[model samples]
Target chain A: MSDAASAPAVRAAIGDSEFDRDTALVPRGPGVHDIDLSAGWTIMNAVNGGYLLAVIGRALGQTLPHADPFTISAHYLTASRPGPAVVRTETVRTGRTLSTGQASLVQYDDDGTEVERIRVLASYGDLDALPDDVRTTAEPPAMPPLEQCVGAEDGPAPGSVSSPIADRLRLRLDPSTLGWAVGAPSGRGEMRAWFALADGRDADPLSLLLAVDALPPTAFEIGLSGWVPTVEMTVHVRRRPAPGPLRVSITTRNLAGGFLEEDAEVWDSDDRLVAQSRQLARVRLG
Target chain B: MSDAASAPAVRAAIGDSEFDRDTALVPRGPGVHDIDLSAGWTIMNAVNGGYLLAVIGRALGQTLPHADPFTISAHYLTASRPGPAVVRTETVRTGRTLSTGQASLVQYDDDGTEVERIRVLASYGDLDALPDDVRTTAEPPAMPPLEQCVGAEDGPAPGSVSSPIADRLRLRLDPSTLGWAVGAPSGRGEMRAWFALADGRDADPLSLLLAVDALPPTAFEIGLSGWVPTVEMTVHVRRRPAPGPLRVSITTRNLAGGFLEEDAEVWDSDDRLVAQSRQLARVRLG
Candidate 1:
């Protein structure tokens, strides 16, 4: 175990935003850190997968030489709760362009046995150092202005569990896709929203990890009921987001055998594509 | 290492297809196998990323309890060549529905030192056992009749390297996007094709791994020159492909700082979605 004197000083820095403070990690040893899973980030009874990914990203940011995550892939083995957990990171390879590594988030049981919750592999690099050339053939999904959107805090559908993370994360939904919130579903299998942090923290590369998975399950639009548990998710950070709320659009094109796939794209205030993600989940229909 | 008598019998099967023969693995010990990377699958002297992934998939299929890959994410650390290699797989978790594991493909130097080539993590499950319910909102891309399309072996652009894997894999390209082959790019950043094995082998769940990446780089349509090395790729298998050639469509929505993302979707002859993939790559401009 590492002593307090050798701990990473980033955790001790004052005036950090709520997003940073909640995701802060204290170095416990080489390639290991102690994380405190904060409360009020749950969707149902389980901690949101994106929040947990952000926590892991924080640890990797400190452990690797690169400052920004280029790509991240995570597999959810078990549900995580708000409590004390440990993240063990191992360097997989270090190259001139990118550095790769893997990390596991684990919690302990009453019997002192370790229970692994999530396993992640990621590559890190400096996004600002990339070339300045931009060529885009795809445009952002059409969305209403921020003031015209439906607030995430408008309350959950009757009998559905409220997601406390929505308020903390500051999400606004597009009205056309909000039919699922009422008794009428559009059956389009899509969801669009605006994302920002409640604490006014400008979106960056690390926060983009959360933004990718922040939207409601697109399955909801198709009248699918029950918790959609994500089995695996991968996110590619294209560029650092400009300062402002992000425009997010998620769509589900196929749902088979009780399993569905959701694809998401995030555009920054500059309307640049910042990050893209895909996740596979199982629908536990009620 | 275990003696030859304890090796897996699947390698000794008499009537395996060329695809199976090229990807066969002989057990060396528990969770380890020896593989021979065959020649003629190169794209600029480096093995195709999808073909390498299939090699790793064969090992995971034998080690994990589940027989079909549900999701696979691979990071290319170094280019692979045709040679003798070894794959080591380690089980991560085994559940009632899915099993997860990780594998590494490494080649040895003349000095007896091992050089790691690719690192992959995958989850496997039985596709046949999944529920018989499928809901789809997306359709396959429109393509001309097979006779109206251009054959992959028609020849490469004047200065580009010819892909030898096309003939073996039986790929037919959509003529509308073939301007890149004539030095007059369409600048659409998209590629569509029909994929089938030349050996008359019916497409299966495992083969979908290779099918997702069988098309030409979409960047070619936008006039990007030089080798585009894939940094990382993730594929999600949705269903077992129906018998016949598959419809594949790949598109690049954004390209920034010399890095680009290509998204692909594969549909069976019945027009059912079988697999989807997204990859991040660096484009080395000539």
Candidate 2:
């Protein structure tokens, strides 16, 4: 679908709803609350981590109402595996300057099976904070212009790879960092670059969360299986990247026992950290 | 109770179990071969993350059906919060030398709100691998001996920093790293260490998960209304640390708004990395 055409679908996928009221709550203590495991609930299995995060995000929204707030940056710390998890929410002091709140999701099996947990910290602030600290360790280098971008409707397309996500969005690869990005037109209200992802599928918000969760991918065609879902993801979205010839940079830090973490930045035609993100992942051979 | 007498109590507290067959099956999966969330099943809630991990460790022991095995090092990326969470498990691969499995938990509210999702990658290996490189990155400094460690019998002599954990364990703060740990005795079983955990009060295993999901007090002591739970944690137990002074090294990597992530490493007196953990915390000011 055209970027414009995809709007309704994306909104349906992410739009607000009363279905959110279906959430189950369990009291943790005097002040804390937890999700009740007895509730028959689960999101679409594809992009679970991010979808689950969206649910928590919505709850946080209830805690602190805001405007057309974007998750400029989000950090998810995994506490326990999802089943029988714990959810805690706290309102940060926004002080009339920012809209910020934090929540945690922990999973456990029995009293003994503590599998995973996640912490999500989010803020919605005024747009006035833009245009500061332009300096970065590096910037997205020059690439083919939009018309010249691979898979551009008009340009000479780069040889296609076996990717499902490729079919969903247009792609641009930066020669400098081998960083590649797949995004629809900017109308969707979010900017995303695709360089590496597991399952080789088009990543929705949920898949994006999972992709960053894995360690950075070095060579193409590497598949990972045994990665823990994202422990935390820090996302800072400046202005959405300019539409065409988008630039992306990705780097990985750790790889031990099929587990790793990597950070990525997407830039617009301008050399700014339009969106910066980090994810922790496990690396296992399929 | 004196430190010596309370040592067992602490052990019991950490080793307690509230899980039954129904809870244990939550992580199994979708079909009859797996656990069903639609059936309204849940896991135990009072156990802390560490203890829950131990239970997972135990379950894994049976899953592999191996006689002799050990976990080298496990790192938790997130923490699970209390809620109506569900779990699904898949065995990524099974091998003679190593076996890997993937588990995901999803939390929801009583009204059926989706709270969080967690994915975990766990690996088990034969103990016959080549010895690990023991070159320590940081040397172990001198500290009080085990005898000087306050036992359940000894209790804090007086005017000591009051702790909720059993008195058998006392914290030794290293000036260099500003890290402290409280541990019970050694020789318990497969794992042993001194560490500090928040009191869960009367909360169940779910609350215990939340209490430990907060940022480990390894470094900064900044105040917030409450602590955020972790999203995921991967733990590999290589060798149990000898009962003595346990040291925890905590460092905060990022904190924006109410979301934060802290990385921690637990070491025995011998300076070996017993466990490496990372927690994502959502900080909210009262």
Candidate 3:
């Protein structure tokens, strides 16, 4: 615990955090919220799926009595761009231990036509109230120390498209998985990275939503190219992070019929599994 | 390819399949369907989550232009009993490659008040239209030949409750995982089995939904007992299955704070990966 003198400083830092600012929401009505999709969090022009989920999650946290999202599943109907959007939430059920709800992120074009981008179903609960007892048969993926990994700012592999989200995040890739960064692509469908906010803000349960999908597509390692759009994604936030960079490992187990499944796991600084996600995406090969 | 004489028999078998009858829905209106919940498909007393999803999938298939469910995510709100229920479906979007929709399973209580049981979001497409290109880094779990496994009809381990669903389906458990039934758990947090319909009904894409969740909870192998109610489950159907018994494997990787995540994979007779699922469930320990 820090001394009382640093209390205000901590509060001020949280207030200035870029993630907090980007995901901030303005209440419009009973269950409607106004949000802005920040351009800083994009991969090849499309807004990050996890970032979009976090935006919707913020509104959900405000609409329901529960403060944290335990399980969230979103299906991307269309690609979203940086613009003003609205999140409409409806409470499906409010129980003693958990609350379930649905939310939709919609935007309008010049003609004022509404375009729905993503639809989400989620359940919220107080994560702090959970028991500390834990039993896990899975171990965190192997990763090198922060100093030995390659930073995202080092730039994309030679011919790949630059990810703007990389600048907003402190992401370091495991050196061995970077063969795709060069001409020689490793056939292994996996990627491991260390993630944190570039502004040094501690990651919370909300940001873990973004952290789950912030890495490059796992299909990249298997020599498949082009934009791989996510059709559906589900994330389970197991616990709150312990205030440091997160360990993320993603793998594509099967690619067939122009589609692939990527499974991701996020571990906190304490090496506890904080989140897990699986996304189904379309893969186009040249 | 079979001769013409075998065609009618095959058609007749499918028509008589119990799975088809139980999940059959009657069109009540444009988007509403009336269905009957079958008690034969229950674990303890609550209807099986996967079976409920398949019933909803059937409705979604009828409502959407696309026929097969490619991706589906369902949140279980309340336990459902065997009786008359209604499934309401809404089309979200129709795309060239995929179509998205939502569905709700509801029933009335003694007071005639409506109660919703499960809510689902799913995308549908034609599995046969998908390209045949295949690349995989994951392999099916190893299991002994079908004749060597322990049949479900042999009865539940010494003190466990008998599953009615098991009697309706031909399910066999790998011998190594049977320790839990004999009062000693393997502590591996995993279960593998062979699955088929007892009526010799050929498993199709729709029935694949049931096979994904038709197993004893993986937590049972870890010495945890009692009801493990699924809070949410998401399934991705990779492709249609080959006609024969299906291989199913489920594993529990993490259990903390009264919740556990079970990941399941189903392989067809031809050893092709047919479906994959991950479910979050509540676990109560004595």
Models 1 onward score TM values of 0.93, 0.40, 0.95
Selected candidate, larger lDDT, 1 vs 3:
3
**What lDDT score is found at residue B91 in candidate 3?**
97
Q: Model 1's CAPRI class?
A: medium
lDDT of 3 at B139: 92
TM-score of 3: 0.95
Docking class of 3: medium
Query: What CAPRI grade goes to candidate 2?
Result: incorrect
Best by DockQ: 3
User: A1-286, model 1: which lDDT tens digit per residue?
Assistant: 1111122223322237777888889999999999889877787778989989989988988888887889899989889999899999988888887988888999998899998888888888999889878887779989998767777456555666666685576677899998888868899988998887776677888788888888888988999876899999999898988877899999898888788888899999898989989899998655
| lDDT by residue (tens digit), candidate 2, A1-286 | 3332112232322233222332445555632566643222222222244345544654565565453133423333332233445667666434353455656665665667644344455654443433332313344644554433333233332332233233323444433222322212111111223332211222223223322322214322122212244433454444434322234555443333343444555555445444445444434434
The first chain of model 3 has a TM-score of 0.94
**Steric overlap count per candidate:** 0, 119, 0
Better of 1 and 3 by DockQ: 3
For candidate 3, the per-residue lDDT at A131 reads 90
**Model 1 misplacement above 4 A:** A1-15, A152-160, B1-15, B152-157
Q: Per-residue CA lDDT of candidate 1, range B35-66, in tens?
A: 98987667777788888898898899999999
Ranking by DockQ: 3, 1, 2
**lDDT tens digits, residue span B1-286, model 3:** 2221112233326547789999999999999999889998998888998899999999999999999999999999999999999999999999998999999999999999999999999989999999998897779889987778887545556886777786677788898887888889999889999888777787888898999899889988999988899999999999999987888999989998889999999999888899999999999966
Quote the positional error of residue B41 for candidate 2 in Å. Answer: 24
Candidate 3, residue B110: how far the Cα is off, in Å: 0.4
Candidate 1 yields a Cα-based lDDT of: 0.83
